[model samples]
Target: MQRFQGSPRSVLSTLLLVLVMGLLLYPGLKNIAVYLFSAITGNYISGTHSVVFLSCPNEQVGKVIARTIVEKKLAACVSILPKVFSIYNWDSEITETTEVLMVLKTRTSKIHRLTEFISGSRVE
Candidate 1:
């Protein structure tokens, strides 16, 4: 049979280990607050509230815009609807053509950033 040793030093070491583990396992205060709020309200965070509609000359450009939006987190989602028929007057001439449409949903705070990204993207 093996004999166990119970000493003050051993007890102190076990308590220190438990304290360290508790500190390590403790969740962040902000995260705990968010979790508690969501738990009580039964609603998860739905960040940002805005939607932007843009048109690009081609499907390729539309995809580029969409990719940039998602990569930058400027928008949560982008819906690309391509080959849209449109008629508009330009230079005193009525023009009918097909274009790609990009509908982006993002935070209102990120609208300017989204605009900059779209404007700077590969579009003509």
Candidate 2:
């Protein structure tokens, strides 16, 4: 094996190049960097957006709620996920049931209205 002949500056440059490549190639690191940049620049404001989760007894209920939310501009999007199994305690009893999960994405300012609408539109 020949003796290494690179200078300190060259070695550091190579190490930095590798680090930059890693940051570009790895998704997790890239996301962290982007998040930091956005945070520092005030481009990503916390509490500006909200994700609300609602459980529905069936797909029809989920669809109805989703549609109403979108139509009323309470949420920008509502994703209805079906066949979600839930086990929980209610009134001192364990209840197990399949439920539809609704994920609502909306502005934080609209969260209160969205929640009120959901409460008033409860299927039960």
Best by lDDT: 2
lDDT of 1 by residue, 1-124 (tens): 9876789899899999999987886766555676667669876555426778888788988887788779889998999998999899999999999999889887666898878876676654
lDDT value, candidate 1, whole model: 0.80
Worst 10 residues of 2 by lDDT: 30-39
In angstroms, give how far residue 60 of model 1 lies from its true place: 1.6
TM-score of model 2 vs. true structure? 0.63
| Runs with alpha carbons beyond 4 Å of true place in candidate 2 | 1-44
| Residue pairs clashing, model 1 | none
Give Cα distance to truth, residue 41, candidate 2, Å.
Answer: 13
Residue pairs with colliding backbones in model 2 are: none
RMSD of each: 11.1, 11.3
Best by TM-score: 2
Worst 10 residues of 1 by lDDT: 42-51
User: What ranges in model 1 sit over 4 Å off?
Assistant: 1-48
